[model samples]
Target: MNLKTAWIWGLVSAVLAAGALAAPAASAETLRICSDPDNLPYSKAEGAEHGLYVDLANLVAQKLGAQPRYVWWLSMNQRKALRNTILAGKCDAYFALPADKDYGTRGMKRTQAFLDVAYAVVAPPSFSFSRLADLKGKRIGVGFASTPQIVLAAQGGYTTVTYRTDAEILAALDKGEIDVAFMWGPAAGYDNLTRYHGRWRVTPVAGEHMDHQVAVAVPAKDAALLARIDAALTELRPQITALADKYGFPQGQPVAVGMAQVQAGPADVALVPTAAGGTPYGQPSPYRMMAVAAADPAAAGRELFNSTCSHCHSPNGASPIRARDLRRLKGKYGDDWLKEAKQTIEEGRPDAGMPTWGGTLKEDQINDILAFFKTIQNN
Candidate 1:
């Protein structure tokens, strides 16, 4: 989501200069963090429940033996808020940034990713299935420009309901207008805990386009601060994870987006469904589904998965690698199993010898592969 437009960018320098020119003397023992004043799960104007970023900032400062101070402002327009506060040096650090250079290339550099978050499928606890096929004609809630909307449109199986924002998506999901909702995980989970009182299950989606890595951002010119922040995040990973969980964020392994995944039938080549808000930014994602392997990609994917991935991740839950068992997915991650599994297949943990098949297999093949895996999940 481009939170700001060209006009907002035009005012950046004036606002930033004002903040810098008005800054007081710095203190070595103070860790200044900039954040939105009213963004729940990230921050709030009332510091009483100082959202995730503030909580994280406090922990980071404590780790550095520094006092934490927040430079709160209206980040309804992130471009203006970030420019005026963080980039202007009114704040030393900014939290909850995408850990990608392209995200905030203007005078800002992101620390190594501290966590990853994604859109999640929110449903009742008794909801049995995970993927689109499992939904089997159920209504799904999605926002404009969201991956779930895109993938569900591609599937054309389940009826796709639309919402303009996360708030609306959650409302539809909570009101039972939609059977399930696909939403940003932090927003969904945080709302689940804070507003809904853990009313629904929030499971993170996987796949390349699904999750975004999050980091603490700092001024690009300040290498020392960047390194220090990165060091602190690494040093305090456990606490950070715990804190993220406390705020209802998805952590560690996440489920893949099975929004388009379904059991094979006569309509092998899926039809693209129209979304309520039209296309995301009016442009189709370069991603396209390839032809399946003729004999039901899921079955093919099953054979392939069992023979290939099964070597590492057993499908029948009989493998020596308990950490890698396919059948025990629900036990480990609830409804996120399919989405998580699809992600693992496409972008394998080469760090652990699982190869990235994204290059080798078409996404449709991978979808069927995940569908096959889904058939075997014990959860």
Candidate 2:
């Protein structure tokens, strides 16, 4: 069977509920790339409608003389989708992923980077700043739980107005809702292009871990095509750059006050965990950035629960993993439920793919997750 057909047999039923699409028809000339249907600036559901990654994918496909086709997979929990979709053979290419070893869990192979993006400032033209201190006392916009929000919070001067989406933060900036927005460069750039016709200013932030290398990723099992992609991307860098400009995505190293960085070449890098957690190249999880000064423990707990744990354990609605059903847990335990939950979480059942988060999360954070869980239990 061709690679696409292999997906049907490999995926567990849980992924289908996450809205994994059936493999569409593919001739030898079609390039089926895995993409999140709702993610903007990177990809989306409709026929290559918009997003930098979708556009970039089409560009590469055209260069390869192949038509681009999407294998839609919701990436809210990318770790799940990576296992159920890309690794399962549902798609051949994943346009943009962090160039780092810890990313993609399975050493998913990647090609040379077409762009390097980071949290950047989006403000009106003539906006200038030398460092984080320059924007002090200004009303700033940041995606809740994002790097900028974390950094600015740590620096302690700006009045932060948090938004859920990068696009929302930019729209808030455009409407005079905030003085500046520190958000993902590509999304802010896309909005500036499509929404404002390229009128907004996007300046990359400088600091350790602020800038991340972005590269095209493919399944690790496939090396023959990976070589071709690497060669094509290197040769197509000029065009890829122009394509980025057309979409309003930041293309090169922003001047130190804005861009340019020396880093190791293309590899898988992990996206930060955002407040809401799972936007690729956005952030990884709220727990990972726990030092960012959470104003409300319960609220922070809620965001973490919904963003990460909600993927499998149904703390509310129906869950696909029947064995993980949290809905009926109220009856299954009494006051000692928390203890049982703690033990289960700290020592995950290895045979079932459940990970032990004990080493990964702090005690307060784990309790925060429990706090959020209590609020949603279906008792």
Backbone atom clashes (below 3 Å) for every candidate: 8, 19
lDDT of each: 0.66, 0.65
TM-score of each candidate structure, all chains considered together? 0.60, 0.62
Alpha-carbon RMSD, each predicted model:
17.7, 13.6
Extract clashing residue pairs from model 1.
37-44, 37-45, 206-255, 206-256, 255-339, 255-340, 256-339, 256-340
lDDT tens readout by residue for model 1, 82-115:
7788888898898766665566568888888987
Task: Count clashing residue pairs in model 1.
Answer: 8
Q: Residue 350's C-alpha lDDT in candidate 1?
A: 79
What's the lDDT for candidate 1?
0.66
RMSD of 2: 13.6
lDDT by residue (tens digit), candidate 2, 63-115: 66565667788887777777777788877898667765566647479877677
Given candidate 2, what's the lDDT at residue 99?
69
